[model samples]
Target: MSQFNLTINQKKYDVDVDPQMPLLWVIRDIIGLTGTKYGCGIAQCGACTIHFDGKAMRSCVLPISNVGDAKITTIEGLSDDGSHPTQVAWKEMDVPQCGYCQAGQIMAAVDLINKKPNPSDEDIHRGMTNVCRCGTYNRIKSAIKLAAEGGKS
Candidate 1:
């Protein structure tokens, strides 16, 4: 077991784990942050998405050793009271159905908005590849637009 120091949501965590362990398990099992879900163990599913130094990353396939000193932001760390623009827009747009993938969706949305600021529909379509089983794509798109608009909608 190797020791890793992770900066998550502005908090610091020191954990001793296998170097090859995926960050998903370390965050969910070791650190007890369940907001980042485990959907497909592979990186294809966005359920394990998190902000790795402000970029959206799939934690399920990211080994702890690869994390290094990057800043990690999970859904729980996005905002203390769920007041982030994306979160607010998500609530306003009523974006989740089964809600299993919402956290990753929100994280991805935040990254999209941060990168594009005012993303076009095409940009959104291209950027958000996260799978949603409940077919909430329309709502998710609308919420992304609202968030890009600074939660005006």
Candidate 2:
């Protein structure tokens, strides 16, 4: 087992694990950060998405060794008070059904907004792609738009 220094969720961890092990396993199994869900072990699904130094990436396929000194943020660490405009907008607009993919979706959306605050519907549609079994696309789009518009805050 190799040791990797991971800065995650505002904490530093020296994890002793297989170097090739995915960051998802490190987060879920080793560190026990359950908010980053595992969907497809491959990179096809967005459920495993998280922020790597403010950029959204699929944790399921990212190796522990690849993390290096990058700051990793999950759904739990996105905002301290859960009042990030996106989070508030999500709740206000009621954007989840099964809620399985919302975390990744939110993480990605936050990245989008960080890069471009007032994204158009096409931009929103292109930027966020979290698959919901309940087909919450309309609500998700609305929440993202509302969040972009400040979530009624």
Best by TM-score: 1
Question: Cα deviation of 7 in candidate 1 (Å)?
Answer: 0.6
Tens-digit per-residue lDDT, 1-153, candidate 1: 999999998999999999999999999999999999999999897999999998999999999999999999999998899998899999999998999999999999999988898899999999999999999999999999989888331
lDDT of 2 by residue, 21-87 (tens): 9999999999999989999898877898999998999999999988889999999897788888889
TM-score of each model, in listed order: 0.97, 0.95
Candidate RMSDs in Å, in order, are 1.6, 1.8
TM-score quality measure for candidate 2 = 0.95
Q: Against the true structure, whose lDDT is highest?
A: 1
Q: Model 2, stretches more than 4 Å misplaced?
A: 151-153
